[model samples]
Target: MLKLDHIVKDFGNHHGLRDVSVEFPANQTTVIVGPSGSGKTTLLRTIDFLEIPDSGRYQFDDLDYDLSKPLTKQEVLAARRKLGIVFQSYNLFPHLNVLANITEGPVQVLGKNKQEAEAEAHDLLKKVGLDDKADVYPDQLSGGQQQRIAIARMVAMAPEYMLFDEPTSALDPELEVEVLKVILELAKMKNSIVIVTHNMDFARGVADKIVFVEDGQIAYQGDPTTFFNEPNDRIKAFLAAGQFNVK
Candidate 1:
């Protein structure tokens, strides 16, 4: 499980996060949905230590960390290892083939033997349904395929929690289905899979719980069923704007 207590981040004049506190339960997936720039990405980044919060307490498994100050190199590395993230862009290395890209981190950062990393990379490729593209470069694959490989690359590290920031936002509608399927498959692994998405349909299908964020704070969060049925005006208005059908 991962918990953020009173998380806050500031950008000189504006606040990126405002006392954001949320918990991602173990073996479950939580979906975060909100308007653009509503602190969704910032929250994910902080959890990954990509953007350290100004102040907060983070609890992961048996560890608890105070985030009010800069973390040491070891601390940052340790935090990053547990929380794996995928960005809107696939962010694949054009110079490497699919298999090579997937194995790079394990062999380099995790210090796994090259042969062992390759074996695991192949398994991950199969998990993402891209086993056939092992030798292909990022430039040779479609956007969806590259994203799947990206997911595989992250998975190779065996993170305890996974974070996705608008994974489908950059894909065309048709391409999104494949990527979403891979994510849903990951959800079945019973890990903490937190996704920030604007695709309401996809969100409804995969989320065990829904978090509605607004203006740098979480406005509402609960089970998916009640979240859709809620009569709160602000939430209702937001859903209406997105044309999301309330379940």
Candidate 2:
């Protein structure tokens, strides 16, 4: 459902990504794994349009995204609505409670009435196993709970695709499992999901395909089981070194 061609991004002296190209199928989970500084997060941001590419072609459905063209107000809004992003850090509002945080996008962006938004938020919270914490503030919730709330918040927006940037990176081991459960459940759904993570287990368990990035380029892309079980010498060496701490 999404295609990127020759995507390249550079930050002056730093190379974020180079000649990266890949396709993400609809209703399937695709995991991008790499060591730090390998451009995993940058690729996600570029796909979500948060980071403009220096040279590339990004096609979503029939629309071609031009990195150089300034986004119109409507175009920007529409493009953003097509995908939801969850950061490594829980980006919840300090002031908003779980319910409010989840409903804010629907109420404001989609222009749904507060009552309608709340109903949708309630259902989404329940889906993420956060229904009981709807009234709780983010600070009051554990990291896992907060992350689930973040997931609910994004799901409430009903985006066409979801981009998760190491959703479990900041959590404790216990909390990581809690967040992973929600993600695993999401992976079962009929929505496209692209995750940037070093968690090898999670990728093997949930990903339909895996893409390994190294030195700002796609080093490997194939069936997760095949890649994980019979990785090439370079990948095997990298995995052996535990360079990215894949666990």
Report the Cα RMSD per candidate: 1.4, 2.2
Q: Could you tell me how far off, in angstroms, the CA of residue 234 lies in candidate 2 after the best superposition?
A: 1.5
Which window of ten consecutive residues has the lowest lDDT sum in model 1? 225-234
Model 2 CA lDDT for position 203: 85
How well is each residue in 1-247 modelled by candidate 2, as lDDT tens digits? 8899888899998888899999999999999988789888999898877877888777888667765556666765666779999998899999998898988899888899999999988888888877898888999999888888888889888889999999999998899999998999999975799999877778889999999998889999879877778788877777767643333
Please report how far candidate 2 places residue 15 from its true position, in Å: 1.6
Q: Which candidate tops TM-score?
A: 1
| Residue 38 lDDT in candidate 1 | 88
Best by lDDT: 1
Candidate lDDT scores, in order, read 0.88, 0.86
Cα displacement (angstroms), candidate 1, residue 64, comes to: 2.0
Model 1: residues >4 Å from true position, as ranges?
none
TM-score of 1: 0.95
For model 1 the local lDDT of residue 127 reads: 83
